[model samples]
Target: MKIVIAEKPSVGRELAKVFGATTRKDGYIEGKGYSFTWAFGHLLQLAPPQDYGFIGWRKQHLPMLPQKFKLAVRKIKTKDGFVEDPAVRKQLDTIKKLFDEATEIIVATDAGREGELIFRYIYYYLKCKKPFKRLWISSQTDEAIKDGFRNLKPGTDYDTLFNSAHCRSESDWLVGMNATQALSISAGNRTVLSLGRVQTPTLAMICARFLEIKNFVPQTYYQISILLSKDEQVFKAISTANYKEKEEAEKLFVLVEDVASGFPAGGNITAVEAKPRKEPPPLLHDLSSLQQEANKKKGYTADQTLSILQNLYESKLVSYPRTGSRYIGDDIFAGVPDLIAKFTGHPDFGKQAQFLQTVALNKRSVNAKKVTDHHAILPTGEQAYGLSADKQAVYDMVVGRMIEAFHQECLKELTKITIQSGVTFVANGTVIRSAGWRAVFNDPEDDKKDEDNAALPKIAVGEQLPITEKSLLEKQTKPKPMYNEASLLKALETCGKEIEDEELRYAMKDSGLGTPATRASIIETLITREYITREKRNLVPTNKGLAVYEVVKDKKIAQAELTGQWEKRLEEIRSGSSVKDFKSEITEYTKTITHELLIAGASISGKLEEEKKAEKVEQ
Candidate 1:
């Protein structure tokens, strides 16, 4: 008998149905020589500090770094303190029995780092030595699933991936557990201060931005805008001059207006240039990018979008929703046509897919080399019916993105009209020759416009035109905007770098501060710890978050780049680079940071104690 374990019961039931496993038991399904069981996300986790002989919160246990972590069944907090979840334990027992009876095991969990760790930890806890194979499929379509089962890979092929996942879990445990405890102890018993690998840096970013904005003083600047009218065509041109005083800008505006009203009869026609530009459609939706777009358009929070996407994934309306890469593998390309056909009946795709016949599908987002454990998030071509409003909104985003990914690049003519009035004044306009992929989303509001350019009128150079109006516009230099969920996610992915090159961004994707699978949870952790709060669309840090930031603002612990470098080293460790050397390095760095944190905590504690003493003396 073959036993298959999935990450959740919904997915397990879907797979079971496809495999003809009709006999349903209490915790599993069995038929057609297959037994399918599932776990509710995580059935087991590492034991907490109290489980390792540590009692209540004490200053003595400032940095509770366990030597060897122990795995325990999942725990739940009840009126009677924390206890193992009965349902999870029972399901684990059932899985163990199935493992004991089956000759081989098939791991059918989600195809990503956390998913790998979920199954591996359970298998290690069960002490199962039976041969196991991996079922790696990005989509839940029957054909995709059948193909995956037919080509099952050896379990050992993913040892490096599993190692990386394990390292991530352990490192987060070490840093998050110790730092949180040490800080909380120093902060007093009234509050619980939490920290983690991703949450700390994310919190720091928010607090720093808030401080910058709070302390900023706006400065006023003045510019001259000239309105030129020729043949009933009124065009606006901004002066290429900035002045601190309004009087100076006024003088220039008057001078330019005079020059434009009475130009020399035969001023030479300077330059005429028209360039053709092609804007390729955006790559397929990864979870973070999709969430970012949804937040911008629908005002949904990051966590909200994540939950909606998870629902869509469970319904099999879309592929895996947690993938980081925006590229699909070559093996999946052959299935694109069939998937595209499913959209033929979709309201948004019926007309758009018809035009797809003449469009040259782009190959930029189809590199198999860039894909890791999972491909990009896309619709599974399944009919999306009877979905909730939120799910429908998210599903539309996925389907639209998939259709856009395969469509032709948007073609446009960029016209730069240069007119002179004592100085060079320019007006620019973009003429959309073809809508191309943009036709998928027909909403005019959805079009992202470039605000720097002005719409240009068709006029030859050196043509005499009357000056319609002139004005000096006063503008204030704006401070950086507060960190919203989408921008914050982008910043985390880039590790604070503002790289404009696409290839470099792709190269830096792996070393991003946190993996796509965990970035959403990291943001949630900050909110749960009361370090940050959502004010409308912005994520502002709390007073406690600001205090923590003030302490670690200059330290490497608060910098995303430092964390990214460590991630790079961990990757190196997975690829035959000595694990012993890596462990030594991590140990040394951990000890160093631990000592620094202790000194910092002592300083904070001393200040609080001194304040208390002064209050008593005053009384």
Candidate 2:
């Protein structure tokens, strides 16, 4: 019999249903000469240090770099301790049984690096040699599944991908395991100070921002404000230049431009500049972009957004959720009209969708070259019903973005009115001539300043207007705001953009600290480790997090560019580059970082103690 393995039971059942299979067995479905089985995400993981005979956290085994990694059944923490999950072991045995009896095997896991690792780990752990083919599809719809099966590629075609995944797993293990051990041991081994290739760099970003905000000194500045009127319509204007001294601003403020100053029509319109701008619609929603949007619009955390999107994907309302690209290929773009038509009845975006059917689609988001492992998340044109409020919110974001991406550009007229009195004053306003894609959500523009008028009265450059009021305005320069989920995710995506080294920056142009699939987990890990906490919508570093950051802030492990270098090498490995060179480099670097942390971690011992005492007092 031919056997098929999926990453999850729901998927396996779905695949079976599509192929007319209904015979359900203990852990699999059997029919039509095929046995469909599945694993619960990952049934196995890289074994821990103690499993390699590094019995306890000891200095003698400071850098416990195992010669070879071992795979053990995934474990669960109970009251007793961490132990192999019984359910996982049973499923492994079932898979083994199926593999042993199969003629040909089909791999139906998620199509990505981590997905490849999940299946390869299982196959190697089972020691099965049954040749297999890979089923790669972005959408989980029945038609996509059927098409994927009809064009299954040879498993050997993905050997390079598997190689890249394996190297990443081993590299992370070498760095995360050794560095975690070294630091924890050096710091009295009283508490676990976890670190990783990506986790440390991420924590460093939070702590650094926190310190920057903490040390920021506000500079008090002053400016003169005046209110001008044209055709009985009033608008506020500010001096074009800011004054460093209050006395200078006060002098300008008393220069008599107001009606109370006995000067009627004192303000003369120096210049009125009007320019039209066309804003193209935003690109489609990639996972990162979607998460950021959800955070900004609905106050959802990155992890929460990912969870909601995953549910939507599993329901087949959307395509893959973890994709990094925000562009779709021509093949997928061919169906954009029909997909847009399906949403013509959507309550919130119905009018926008109906409007799109009459115009040529904006192909700004269509580029096959930019499409990566999976196209940007898109609706499968599958009708969705009975979704909860949260699901509905996320689903609407997907559907709304589709309409926006394919709609026309928004047309706006920008007006700047310059006034002459004592010193020059200016007022700005924006008028939307055409809503275009902006009509989809009709949300207010985020970049509009509070000082800007919604609309300005029409006036000529040579016209004079009455100055109704004037005052000396006091303002202090504000520090950068704390990293909220939306801003933080964007920062993470473009972290390498600031690197001084051209090669390093270019290497990381496409890759950031973590992949789209792993970034949510990385944020969750920091919170779980007590390195950061959610303060309202912002992620603030905790005392414990600050303490850890202080120790490793200057280390290579804490640098985001270091991850970029590794990502470049990993990409090279995916393109048939030598893995041995990268592995050797990682081994050496692990030894170096492990030694550095062993010494540097001692400084944080007292800080950790203070945190413990503070926790006790709070409790």
Candidate 3:
């Protein structure tokens, strides 16, 4: 019998149903000469240090770099401690039995780096030598699955992809295991001061921003404010320049441009510059962009958004959720019109969808070259039903974004009115000449100018207008706002852009602190380790986090450039570069960081104690 394996049970059942497989057995479904099985996400993980004879957290086991990594059944936390999950071990045995009995194996796991690793780990752990073909499909819809099976590629074609994933897993283990043990041992073993390659740098960013905001000194500044009228339409304007001293602003504030100052029609329209701009529709929603938008619009955390989108994906309502690309290839773009038509009945987006049918679809998001492991997330044109409120909200976003991406460009007229009052003042306004994509949601503009006038009355240069009011507006310089989920995700995507080393920056331009699939977990990990906390919408570092950041802020492990270097090497490995060289370098760095943390972590013990005591007091 041919055997197929999927990443989850739901997906496995869906695939089996598509193949007319309905005979359910202990751990699989069988029919039509195929047996469909699955792993619950990851069935195995790298064995812990103690499993390798590094018994306890001690200096002697500071850098416990295993000569060869071993995979153990995934574990769970029981009241006693973490142990091999009995169910997972049973599933592994079931899979081993199926692999032994199978004539040919079909790998139906998710199509991405992590998915590749999951299947490879299972296959190698089972010691199965059966040749397999890969079923790579972005969406789990029946048609996509059927097409994917018809064109299964040789498993060897993804050997290098597996190599890249293996390197990543082993490197993470080497770094995370060694660093975590080293720091935990040195800090009096009071509490687990967990650390990882991505988690540390993320924590450092939070701490650094917190300190910056805490130390910022605000300076009070003043600007001249005036109200001008043209044809019975009143608009507000502000001085073009700010003054440090109120006395200087007061001098300009009383220049007698108001009616009270006996200066009617004192405002002269020096220049009225109105320029038209064409704003193309935003690209389709990649995971990162969708998460950011959800955070801003619905106040959903990254993890929450990922979970909801995953549900939508499993239901076959949308495409893959973890994709990094925001562009669809032309092959997929060919069905764009039909997909848009599927949503012509959507309550919120129907009008826009109806209008889109008559126009040439925008080609901004259609680029086969930019499509990576999978295309950007898109609706499968499958009708959705009985969706929960959260799921429905996310589903609507996917549909709405699809409409916006293929709609016409928004034509806007930007007007800047330079008026000569007592001091030079300016009024800015934006008029949407054509709503275009904006009509999909009809949401307010996100990039509204500061002190912008909603609508400016028509006026010509060299025309005089009455000054309605004047005053000296006091303002204080503000520090950068704390990082919220939306801004934080955007920052994580471009973290390497500010690197002083041009080569490293260039290397990391395509990657950031973590992949789209892993970034949500990174934030959740920091919170799990007590390194950060959520204050309403803001992610703030705790005292414990600040303490750890102080110790490792200067270390290479807490630098984005380290991840950059690793990413550059990993991509090379994916392209058939030697993995041995990369592994050797990682081993050396692991030893170095383990030794440094053994010494540097001692400094944070007192601070951790202080925090513990503070927590006790609060309790």
TM-score for each predicted model, relative to the true structure: 0.92, 0.96, 0.96
Where model 1 places Cα greater than 4 Å from the true spot, the runs are 54-64, 258-272, 443-455, 500-503, 570-578, 602-619
The digit string of per-residue lDDT tens for model 3 on 1-619 reads 9999999899899999999999999889999999999999999888888889999888897798888889998999999999889999999999999999999899998898899999999999998888999998989889989999999999998999899989988998998988988888888898888888778888888888889999999999998888888778889988999999988888888884788888878999999999999988988988988999899989999999999999899888899999988889999999999999988898899889999999999998898887878899999999999998889888999999999999999999999999997689999988999999999999779789778988899999999888888877899999988998887887677662444332343234355777788899999999998899999999999999999999899887898767756866886788899999999999999998898899899999999989889999999
Q: Once superposed on the true structure, which residue ranges of model 2 sit more than 4 Å away at CA?
A: 496-509
Stretches of candidate 3 off by over 4 Å are 496-509
Model 1, range 39-107, lDDT digits (tens) per residue? Answer: 998888888888887787776875566778889999999999999999999999999999999978999
Clashes of 1: 0
Residue pairs with clashing backbones, model 3: none
Candidate 1 vs candidate 3, lDDT winner = 3
Candidate lDDT scores, in order, read 0.77, 0.89, 0.89
